[model samples]
Target: MQMSNRIKEIIEVILNSKGYVTIGEIAKQINVSDRTVYREIPEVTEIMREYGVQLNTVSKKGMAAVGSLEDMKSLRISLGMEKQIYIVDPRERIDFILLYLLQQDDYIKTEALAIDHHTSVPTVRNDLKKVKEQLGVYDLHLIQKKGEGILLTGSEIEKNALMINILLNHADEATLYQWLRREGDVSNPFTKRMEEYGYLDVMSACYLRMKNIIRDQCELPAMIKDREYLEYILLIAMMIGCHQKGQPYEKVFETENFKGEEQRVTRQVKRELEEEFHILLSQEEEQYIKWVLHMGMIQDTSSVYTVKNRILDSKIHTFIEYVEDRMGLQLIRDKELKESLYVHIERALTRIRSGMCISNPLIEDVKKDYEELFGIIREGADRIFQDDFFPDDEIGYLVLYFAVSLDKVMKRSFRILVVCSGGMGSSKMLAHRVEQEIPEICVSKEVSLVGFGQENLDEYDLILSTIPLYIDKRNYLKVSPLLSSNELEQIHEAIKRHKYKTMRKITVREQERRQLESRDNIESLETLRLLMDTGLRVIRQFRIVETREKDLKNNLLRILSEESLCSLPETEEKMKKQQSYYIPVTDMVYYEAVLARMPEPKLFAAHYHDDQYLSNGEKYTDVIYAVYPDQASEYEKNILNRMLESVIEDRDIQEMIHRADEKGVRQWFGYQFKQYLAELLAV
Candidate 1:
């Protein structure tokens, strides 16, 4: 889907400003209602169909967009110049006061503003009237101090402006704009000049931004304006830029005040950077970079070294290797100057931290722009991670190629064992097939059928088999008789069952916690444990029961007649169905005689020997255990003896006694439960 030109313009404007612009602001820009703007967003997004543009809602603020520099450039090209325009139209004196308040360095009282502008206090008071009107258009406000002065309340816009100014101050706008103008013209003179400065991609642009800052000094609002201090600041920014571009440059900062301190720190930084990034820098440069980064940069610079839990420029390049191995992608080749993979790497690392679990999508995007030598191929799904479903043919191919890549970096050979038999022809065929499937796998040995079962299983991490053989110990996964349809189906079913079990536990726990909201009789440890055990048993048994009228009707009758079966639905559609039985019930109760005599005494355990537990072919469901849990362990023999006695004594009057007990003496109800169970069972 493609977004309308209007909505596209709104997104570009929001991103370019780097501030949370409200829906009203966007509406005014395109001359639309707040409702219309909200309606267009989702619809326009569907049209664009690009996941690269991220939309987020800020608390107490409005919507905002975040994307890469390339994504930003694309958006800008689509929106054109209409989106860049900002109008500060104020209708009242307060609005004017607010604007002036935001711009002024010192607080200005209404009396002061009146005197400065040669106007009366009433005139200045009248200017304050426009403040509310301006609030509807922009995220700005003015504070009145009764008599002291009026001050600006919001400073987000100023913060953004400061950052932008710092970034753009190094290169003249004309030169940068011209380079931007001929963006796609690879052979253009401006492009060539940018290339010479190492600005091939956004990395180059960032390099320039840093380079200019280093070459020319900057003065923050907090600093007293001085040419010498300003010059040093610019040099500091340039040094950061050079470090960003992966360039090695000497540092000449005067460190006489803390020469010893600087020298010790500089040595550590150089050693650390070299050990981490595999890139070496002189001790002087390292110290200069460290001092500037720690003291000069606005944001914390510690993150520069730590990218996604690994050192960014470490000697082992652990992060880079991990990303390459996982993402299966690489950087674009540029000869103008070798660009460090650090910039893109940091972003990717940040993304990984933000829940990017899979690397294929990110890798594929990079591969589109870089060729084979520069582009990385993920060591297939099998090599990077374990997959029980990996095919025998694909396995060999993946192993061979993946091993070669690992060998290039780590210089290690992997040993593989091929277990085959039947004859030399079959064994040779298996070896050839294995070699083709995983070209990188070095088959150290091939064994025949004679000792295959007795052979050491510890030699291989994975086993491929055409026939079943048992080797019980060690870390190993069997690829199966073949990577066939049945195997895949089995894996899918296993995963589904695992997921369902997890969901069941979560659902039951949530329901249990919710019981605190009401007086639910079933909410107790013993009752819950019984319910869990019963539910799982019923779930397992139902999978095997076949559909038949006799079976369904009998099961339903058995559930309906149970002592505390309570109730069930009378849905006509369910009754008319001639399929496998399914019962949805909230409660069930076990007969006391059965509960007492049974040794396990579990909540969900059900043994339907007759039709008493079912009702109208709906099938008996939700078996409830009725035994006293405290007496379970010690009184098992006593309970069985009482169960036989109750059968004979209350064989006829058990139901009547139960109803009477339920109404008056519920505590003594367990004593009569065995009698009711005996009569119900007619045993």
Candidate 2:
């Protein structure tokens, strides 16, 4: 059925939102009344159904079009919103024009070129000026005849290099992979332009086969298995496919002399291609592949060290010394930093010498964040290299290396113990995350619940656990295995608290210690009084029940309302507004577990179970709900957070909750409370 433009606009707004879009939001976006939008809902829903999209609406939270990305793309195409023939952006138009001319062997008329681009002859003429300057970089020329339109005059080798450069500069490896695999958005500007020249079709045919040949046949270094190597394989495949299809740049030439290893690897690549694809590679093609492979290997320090360049090494040492003297730092002492810098500088020098440009996508970000450091490095590079050969892109990369080294040298490291349910994969992952996110932390050990219980707690400055520690240990914080931003801030605060305590202890005299002990006794008494009151209320209200409800939202409503913990509408609204509060804990086990928070301030804990699939397609068999008071003191908040973490991390607690063992749950809570009291009085 044909839909009106208003209905299409409403559908577009719904599809664009990542989450639920309210009726008011849609109305405002389309400049219509809420009533008019309501009138169009049925028609919009009907049209969406044809594309396998479901229009899901909630009472308070508006509506969302739920479907696969492909379905959405198809719906957009049906609405005539996906592909545009004419390029609008001037920069993009120049790129497409260059690609168009390079793919053609015969000279075309200016009018035909203008018609293909859907632009005027004057605009095409203006774009050709910039294109000419770009061509000059590779020693290529744009020759125009009075009658004939234009022709790209250059060696096959130089033209091929320019083509590869354009592709690299246009998209990064991830985007290229998506395009080559036919997984990228078809309407993207780059994809649309490349498709106009049939580049996508050629890449789709050669991508997987070339990937396999490179992986199985080439003797690649360990460190070169990243994006750089992927790009190298992509370019080689493109050159080969373009040659086989009788493209303009297919002339063969004699191979140039290369290193023994590069020649051997290139021969294997050529043999594999000829055997598998039934096409022989010319010597010039072999030479190009060999050169590309060598360039990729230069990024790997281990591979570069295999063939030492004394001059490059000497220059790098001098560069490091210059930066060290300027910044009053001892960077020369860092061996790893020196090695990484050497590899990057070597790659940068090669690209510079060969008139090749490497794009740094993060150059602007690096300049903004480290403006002063960027200037110093740029100056050092200019002085050491005897000219300003390094562009801002290369300078930006160098700045990152020194920035990281400087961070490590300046930050004070503290020993930490990372605890989890098991001292295995999950614990190691958490440990790595802590060290990566908080460089000030040095993980002293990764321990399981059982291992943590037996260790001397005073050995480490702080203990971070993915699960709850029932015992009330000082300097302990419960954190998610995958730490979020808020949790990171909490960790920083915990470090500050520990530092303050340590300073107080160090400065205290014997008399001050005695006085502090006397004051602590009074505070301990008050803490005990508050703990008993909160503990009784929590233990009395704790609940565990086995449920048969299959729908997650329905089960949440039933549990929350039936227990009188929170009202149904409040729970529903919270669920709709904050979907992120519902977290999936693990999927390695037979039954998936999810933890959810309640909006209410009352202390409440419960377990509900049913056989259902989570949004991620995991089969969820259990849901643990934890509600902490909105107005809670530090001690109370810590207790509730740890309790929730225990439900998330402790397998035993999970098993008990899943079994709906009320007796066991109560007993565990009592024991944990006792431990908390004992630790409090001891302190």
Candidate 3:
């Protein structure tokens, strides 16, 4: 078998190591399986033997190098390890083209690029096609002028977003900080380190200097919440600063989004930035800064799920129920699924409201992979929403959320190995606590540090260690022996990290065509993006009521009379008509736990008139009303029923009644009926 480049690296590590290292250790370092190492070891050994350097395998210890020091030195020379030349992968030439264009004042010839990379001009043209594909993701298009040259033209926000993606993709936590700390040229080792993450080179040192200046001069408002977001804002700042050296100010094209207080905040930020950097800001630069503060840093929406909880909850229920009926999957009981799908709905609503046109890079892959699921989500959304407006990208996200949950639901129990200290006292305590605290951890094996060496590391999904170990890796955890609050939190974080790591590894394998396909991998990534997004569409419709009407029955009848479409004064009479045409099933859901646990006392009521009711000659307008002095909680979000069905139990449904007017009641009733169709279809 032909030895791969990775195998060659492994040979170097084995040969240079002072002591024997196990295949597990090497595999962990390389982010592969021990079986892969085993497969390649023989080939590496054959290559090593040609230089008279022997590969020695110790039974339980691992592998070692046994040969003359000069012979080993000669082997390194033969492999060109001394001055390794980086041959950029074909997949990464696109990034090179992008970075190359970013630094240019005008479009350089494609032939120049081909010569720089020592490739044919046609190859450079092909690379440009891929560059266009990538730019399309950021909503920026490549402008190939007939005679002048090629360039990128888009809103400054879009440009900043793309630059941030390229600059951050190659670096880890340490290297990112390194660039921020050092003030020198950033000689990124792309071909050696960032082969998996696309290779591109930009003057990161200059950018980081701007970042440091920005940080030192101003205190960013809390609205600039995340580090990644702050970085994007700084990139925009750098671009503006770079352009400002020649022109004191530049005029920005789009100013409609920036007005009044937003414009003022933008000016203040610009003044502060200019003073710190000793530069002057133009009207355009000020407006661009306003764009960063408003859209990039400050929130465009209230918060994720800040909308009427019951309305969102109802939508989530309808989505899940519809998906269940269509896909034949039992999804209602999956709390994690419900949480994720609910978040997707919340973020989707927020994105729509914010008017931010974002595209999913994997939309094509999602459409191709889970065509049926995507259709089910779109169809289900239409059935649930009055005017469903999910873009294909949004639908892709929804499919991913559901697909990942389904994949997990279909997945079997995963095992974890717990490696403790040599002494059993603390390790046993931790082991027992781990078993008790984390019920999701289905299976576990307890072993000492030395005993861990005997265990097949591949068989277990994770390794939980109480003490620090020499070989730390993905799916490995180090925790305090006591399993304290912090330790438990670590366990929680470790689980999440392990999940993403596993998903990423699986995706890499699948994308490389090594594996057939893992729906879980793609879905996991989609779910990850939704989990990261924060914002929600805000609506204020809930009402509070206080009157002599203390009785639940009286309130129900009075609200029905005021809100019902049929003008039926008597709810009893309306019920009789509904019974004749439609069966009214009422569920009394208790909010004892919800009410007692509510942080604030917020009471509201809502009523929905069944669309089917008042159809023909029916005198009854089907309306359901519930009253509660509490906020809309998750359990109470959706009242699952047909015409004239009432739920007095859920916090959200009950809370809607307190402040519900005729219009609000009627609107809510439409949502309830949509969900009703989902439950009806299942039966």
Candidate 3 overall lDDT versus native = 0.54
Q: What TM-score would every model get versus the actual structure?
A: 0.26, 0.50, 0.41
Candidate 1: C-alpha lDDT? 0.40
What ranges in model 2 sit over 4 Å off?
A: 10-49, 52-76, 82-175, 183-185, 217-221, 241-264, 275-279, 298-307, 364-372, 410-437, 440-683
Best by lDDT: 2
- Tens-digit lDDT track for model 3 on 375-442? 66777777787564666767887888887776665333356677877976666777778778876564
- Candidate 3 residue spans exceeding 4 A from truth: 1-87, 137-139, 143-151, 155-157, 183-227, 242-271, 280-325, 330-400, 407-683
Better of 1 and 2 by lDDT: 2
Q: Give each model's whole-structure lDDT.
A: 0.40, 0.67, 0.54
For 1-683, candidate 1 gives per-residue lDDT tens digits of: 45666776666556544346788888887787889888877855553337465676687787766655566456555556323223232232332344345446556777877764455798667666645443432334566666577776543323222222222332334434434434321222223333444434443333344334333434332222232223233333344445555654553443443324335544553554445445556656665644443332232234434554343355225423543433233311221101123433333333223221111212223333322222122332223333222222222322333333433332113344555545555555655655554454445666766767666755543444444455431122233333455444433343343333333333333333334334345554454455345433322322111123234333443443342343334221123322222212112223332222222432222333333334444333222223322235422323333332332222122332322222222222344443433422331
Q: What is the C-alpha RMSD of each candidate to the true structure, in Å?
A: 21.9, 18.3, 24.0
Q: Order of all candidates by TM-score, from best down to worst? A: 2, 3, 1
- Model 3: lDDT of residue 115: 76
Any runs in candidate 1 off by more than 4 Å, and if so which? 1-288, 291-421, 424-464, 467-683
